[model samples]
Target chain A: MGFELETADHPERLRRVAIDPLSRVEGHGKVSILLDDDDRVRQVRLHIVEFRGFEKFIQGRPYWEVPVMVQRLCGICPVSHHLAASKAMDVIVGAGQLTETAEKLRRLMHYGQILQSHALHFFHLASPDLLFGFDSELSRRNIVGIAAAHPETAKRGILLRKFGQEVICATAGKRVHGTGSVPGGVNKSLTAAECDFLLADSARMIDWSLAAVQLIKQLHRQNPALYDNFANFRANSMSLVAHDGSLDLYHGQLRVRDADGKLLFDRVDYQAYGQLIAEGVKPWSYMKFPYLVGLGEERGWYRVGPLARVQNCDRIGTPLAEAERQEFLAYAGENGRSGPLHATLAYHWARMIEMLFAAETIAALLADPALQGDQLTTSGQRVAEGVGVIEAPRGTLIHHYRVDDDDLVSVANLIVSTTHNNQAMNSAVREVAKTYLDGRRLTEGLLNHIEVAIRAFDPCLSCATHALGQMPLEVLLYDAGGAIVGRLCRASGGGLSS
Target chain B: MSDVFLLDGEQVPFTVGQTVMAAARAAGRYIPHLCWHPEFQPHGSCRLCTVKADGHFAAACTLAARPGMTVDNRTAELDDQRRTLLQMLFVEGNHFCPSCEKSGACKLQATAYELKMMTPHFDHFFPDRAVDASHPDLLLDFNRCILCELCVRASRDADGKNVFAITGRGIKSHLIVNSPSGRLADTAMSLADRAASVCPVGVILAKGRGFVIPIGERRYDRQQIGAAEEQ
Candidate 1:
């Protein structure tokens, strides 16, 4: 359950620390830290314990069913899976290009998914830590506590999430496991009444979403040191960008940027992802480490999701969000230049910005006359293999499928957003542990701080691990002799014990 | 006077020799079931409707109701057993709900939802079943067949065509077409036939008609099977 690290002063001695069942993110994971005899942190590993073989079991199903089936991989972001798989199927069916109505409806669903998912992560999950101090009373560090302390903010968060869910239901058919999107195209379209329903509260949603950006800005400004250096490790960034180099979550070409904000790759097709992106496996974790193909194992690790998306994209398509993005980039530093933002805490700010973008995009799509078109699907000649990629709320998600002559899925490989950020999350954890955990007495707050670093990425272990049940995080510290010196465990129901 | 049985403390009236499942359905009470259709003879397959009558366990679909007999259909123990049985059915075949066109309306899925079965619990059998798309109007995805025999009974008793029957045994047992060519296209099976809609899962579906009703508005989307049946 633990590893050993040797120090120069004590060649024969080793130290170990472990965090089991990492809590608050979605699904089970743990962290192991190895410290030298001199108390210097040597190594950190984030271990994902659960596995659901979506890739293996999906092999024999019909290609048309891949979209609906693969979506079961993650409950929190099923829309992402639904859309990604649908797009892949679109290619398989030789309908790579969708009808105007079909494309707009899918776009609406994708934006709604991002809005709701980001709202849940910020309001329900991370708000407790941000609003209250990391070491605040465990009882008072949750959405309920947020409601008690700041009712309007909590209410706004809930309503915003409700609006997003409503959008999902209106477009996709249900909030959870919807079947609106099908191979070649979507099966349904938004009626004028549904569009009107979203438009009724469109103004309020946009305003609240903008206010979320302000709130996060205030949090960051209030605690610069904590937010800036919490897990400040430089890494590459990746996202999908429109042909005009604008932010596009549902459809876009691939783009990657190095830590210095220099473009590593741009406008590349996702079908060629293997040529530019490679996955590395370690013995300690079930999650694979994906890095830039040429950067090698050590330096190739890159970050994805909100922070990366915000940093890698040139501009937001919607006007309101575009203005907010300009202000956000200026505040984050190096005016008028595009580059990766290394601060891990910036993810919350970026997430708020994306939520605003999603709201604005929803408004724009609703106003479009093409959205009401009667055409919903187009059939074409079937193909054997296809790839689909989209920016899920978490980050870039890819679904690749290969079918036999019978049109049964012979292979399925999914690269979820969390898996793309696996290495970076572990690196961030190590950075935080080394900076905060000085080999002194470990406190509950210290353990939570390490968790804070991972939460910043908003990693969805449920999607990554494909496992069921709650994730209860536990942390253990071992001395030079590899004996347990300290322990902190967080249960699934928001209770922490030592 | 009609005979009455005590079901979970409620008095449910039933005709003599009527099965517990029929009695429960007549009384607007839902005993989770598959393979036993109202118009068809009880087949006693898919033991999901197992209930405790007095002290013995029996399939509610076939267990004849007795006057004043106390039947336990909604007990925790029965629910747990039902969940395990549902899990076995799930892993025994590839019942991928997310991808199924009949997902929300599927009886197997609705029953599982009613019983609160979360994970499959057991390893997937991943059986290499055939997808019979030979029929011009209907699609038969054998991978999703739960062996409920609803189609078999409906075809024989209601449609009088004997178009579908069960062949093989144990894990290998599956629904088969009765046509000389063993293909749905060669059979007299029509979309209008009761057998066409008798499947409890995604095994039989209309071709080019997937997701026509959309997802959220499907049969069991908002309401569980128990409530949906009442409507």
Candidate 2:
């Protein structure tokens, strides 16, 4: 860990750190932390340079195309956008309650989406950091590192993600950008053959998901102090829960709980989410800071995603996941949901639990004959406005749309899950900067500590804003007066430059 | 109709009045086309059926099938030009196939695949085309219009309704409804009209009946464009 500093000759400047291409996350991002001459961390901000104006561009599109068109938001979790947009259209078309087949098919697709997306993040993206030390040599801290060092885990992860994709292909008609979910109902139901094929593969997926849960747990147990304290913070948790107060990723009322797992608000209809959630804009990043209106913007900032969903839900629906939940609850002692999630790294554990639950749910849906039913759609009196909310793999996703009498979308407001966790991610980055980089030497591997905190949230900055291009991981050091005093660039091909 | 021509070195016979495309069709060959439907008079707007006839580029749908004339139909160069033409049509309009109801059944998509077109190879127009949903049973999404004028031919020549017409020229050319309100609902183009199903793309659609045909089972799902043309 040595400096390859190229200075701009500002002798009075101490140092400034900027992490460009926040490596191994969902999309392109940069984190700039400014240190003053007093060696104090002056400012730490996460910058999303791309401006994603999807909500604005989607205006005037036919409500039906919204499901498929909105998939451009994030390649990883396009299904979340697809389904959220579809749910919104269901209301626009006056499809109050979907046919049994339609709802089951949609649920199946969603579970597959969560199962695949979570598996991808845990095994492909985050495992590199978790398996290898965050400060390990750059070459050995990616999915390749996991594959070389831990072959069985890598194989399991790959197989789990593939099976989840197969499930999606069967339900949605295509693995990528499937047009299954329409305005009123799903386009097609699963054939008996498709259902049986997924059933044959379900047990393996379940076993692999359980293994993932065990793997994360083992890692947590090995370093309890580090796992519990890394980027740990107190904030409100939000997610969608079923009518019975159980985990329901597809559709339900909003439930928000504090850090102690005490209910701040539960069973709040998401249609009135505007009354509860307010977005704050900062010129630095394109990502919006969404906070609860009741607490106001200052203290209203909350966390969503695996940690929040696990913390906020009363219980999971499936038997296997419910059992795992019991073991996870032990970590929080009597409270169960509160303390365990405060450890940001525990998101991996919660994510695996959800993946297992998704697998279990997929199996149950395959066995149900409703998937083979012919009643795929139903319609009633049309409405001019509709709201859809779903717990996407990332977190709670909200989509509100208003259409003219001609059924063309007149207005669209989308609150992506990644944007919801923007403030929390910034806080985590600030904590890492203070803890690791304030008075210490700025080195290559040490910078990854900040990225580790962000990876825990699995934040899709592409959804927060957008871009995905592989370039040198640049750290541009600036002076107090905003001149580039020093610079270090970690090239994408595993070389360093100054 | 038995006037014979050497088409790609194969002898293809045609009627005295038949064009190269009609002759190829009768002889169990396929000349990729968009605007030249068999049921209507050939209007060579979309140059998808371009071919080398006697060492000169010609529209196969309009070129007369003269006896003993050499023609190159499926040569590499001709297919390349067809691919370029298809790419141009694709970029000139908003032709997103993912959510389109006519995705698997569209002639433009089928022709592009048959020509082995990998990409549009041009920046998209991102055209802000109008969507008219005034009709109770039909939806007119103008975004995907390729200006092929099949509906125009079908309405004027076959259905006698004159419900649709192509107005303007070149990039500014657009399809319009022949109604006082200039809306599809204001016209008498019902589901039974020949113009209703004559669209080669998703410009006209039935309301409340999209995505009913599963993607894999649509017309071009299993059958390629060439095979469908031959049939």
Error of 2 at A432 (Å): 2.0
Task: Report the C-alpha lDDT of model 1 over A1-498, residue by residue, as the tens digit.
Answer: 011221224433656667776666877778866667667676677888878799997886667667777888888889999999999888887896899999999999999989988888899888988999888887778788999999999999999989988888888888877888888888888778888889999889999999999999889888888876678878888999999899999998999888898998999999888888888887777888888888777778788998998878889988888887887778777545445568889999999999999999988898887777889998789888889999999899999999876566888888999999998887788778778886756667777888888888888886833322224666676766667887767677757788
Best of the candidates, TM-score:
2
Per-prediction CA RMSD (Å): 6.1, 4.0
- Chain A alone, TM-score per model: 0.94, 0.94
Candidate 2: CAPRI quality band: medium
| Candidate 2 i-RMS | 1.8
C-alpha lDDT of residue A108 in model 1: 93
In model 1, what is the error at residue A181, expressed in angstroms? 0.7
Error of 1 at B200 (Å): 4.6
> Individual DockQ of the candidates?
0.35, 0.57
Against the reference, the lDDT scores of all candidates come to: 0.84, 0.84
TM-score of every prediction relative to native: 0.81, 0.94
> Tens digit of lDDT per residue, candidate 2, span A1-498?
000111224435545678887877777888877677766666677887767788887887677778888877877788899899989889989999999999999999999999998988898888887888788877777777788999998888888888888878887788877778888888898878988988998988898898889989899889887887787777788889999999999999998887777888989998899998999987777878899999888778889998888767889989989988888888757333435467779889999999999999999999999999989988889999999998899999999999987767889999988899988888787777777777776888778899899989988887633222234698887767778877888877767889
